[model samples]
Target: MRFPGFTGEWKETTAAETCSEFKSGKGLKAENILSEGLYPVYGGNGLRGYTSTFNHDGFFVLIGRQGALCGNINIAEGKSYITEHAIAVQANTENVTGFFQYLLLNMNLGQYSDQSAQPGLAVNKLLKLRINLPSKEEQQKIATMLSLLDARIATQNNIITTVC
Candidate 1:
């Protein structure tokens, strides 16, 4: 369904079609993580620790690749180290990154997950998942609105934490 004031139907595409890069993180060992490092080390669930090095250099979306929280989505910006348990996705274009992250967040990726003793998100399978995409302008509008809401939520949570 299209948002209010947006015209036409959204186009259906796969993650691989929209994201130029969809690769699993590599080379980072837990022992290599430094407590006093320059970059954040990201794992499946989120910031696992810090590292002296970074493999990625820009804004990208990270999906939990293997874990109980497989399919969880997170965004990484600047220089950061991503662990093998997470998949990094970079949009083919700049304007779509925020929208793509939001879409990934809304998706029931766990449904597509490989059911086993340890749950895992197959990058090949995830790449084929269909996505409905709106116009760039519509995407920007939606992203901006969501970002504002997210900021407000973070602020509210901080206030609640401080009060408690």
Candidate 2:
């Protein structure tokens, strides 16, 4: 989707150009999980635990590598700890916007998914796919705009939950 109020091309790019190495998170057992920690849990599609150890920092997006939620998208700020089933995408922000990249991924890639007895994202298909482009400035602005709406909606939902 094109960002309004900005007129620029969304150049198509392969995932290879837009991303670096995709790493998987370490597997941690639920029974051994520590309740108090600083790390954020990343899993197939949800959190399994937290840990103090980490591998990457700053903004990064994650995609489920296997399972029903395969191809599911998520983003994190600061430091994070993801699970083994998720693949990390370090955005090619120099050529695109990170937030916009995250938004763009949500459009769905199930068709490209490598079907198995168990479903999962086909890395081979996913890694080479191209996406329409957006300028970093416009991407940031669009991401911010969407983020504010999301925050507002979440707050409203919280308020409603509390009232109920």
Candidate 3:
């Protein structure tokens, strides 16, 4: 669906074209994980635990790369450690990070996983996949709206958790 005042068709591009970096996270052993630490560690299933060291900082989208949950995506921000189980993606100057997060979330990447005992998403295959993109202004508008909605949902979930 097109938003009001947005004209022209979205440009078609591959993930590799829009992203500056698409690579796997560094390895972090299970022993390194701590119940409470300075940084959060992200794995295939997300938020595996916390750790003393971090491999990533700033905002980026993480895609699960192995196991049954392969192809799952999550947004990571600030000082954090993205384990080898997740592929980190950073949008280029032309695109908004939040916009890509929403786009990847809707993509249902699980379908692209390799059919093995433990499904896995290959970084190269994901990079080659085609995606549509609107103008920077339009991307910002859409991402802001969706992020606000996500915040509201989180708030509601917190309230439910507290009440119930």
lDDT for each residue of candidate 1 in 1-164, tens digit (9 for 90 to 100): 55789997788888878888898998687798877789999888888889888999998889999878999999889999998999998888734788878998999677778889999999998898888888888988898889999999999999999999
lDDT of each: 0.87, 0.70, 0.92
TM-score of 2: 0.84
TM-score of every candidate: 0.93, 0.84, 0.94
Candidate 3 wrong stretches, greater than 4 Å? none
lDDT of 3 by residue, 19-108 (tens): 987899999889999989999999887898899998988898999999998988897899999988999998899999889999999999
Q: Which 10 residues in a row give candidate 2 its minimum summed lDDT?
A: 95-104
Ranking of all candidate structures by their TM-score, best first: 3, 1, 2
Ranking by lDDT: 3, 1, 2
TM-score of 3: 0.94
Instruction: Report per-prediction Cα RMSD to one decimal.
Output: 1.6, 2.5, 1.2
Native-to-model Cα distance after best TM-score fit, residue 9 in candidate 2, in Å: 1.8
Q: Scored by Cα lDDT, where does model 2 land?
A: 0.70
Model 1, 55: alpha-carbon shift in Å?
0.6
What candidate 1 gets wrong by more than 4 Å, as runs, is 1-5
Predicted structure with the largest TM-score when compared to the true one:
3
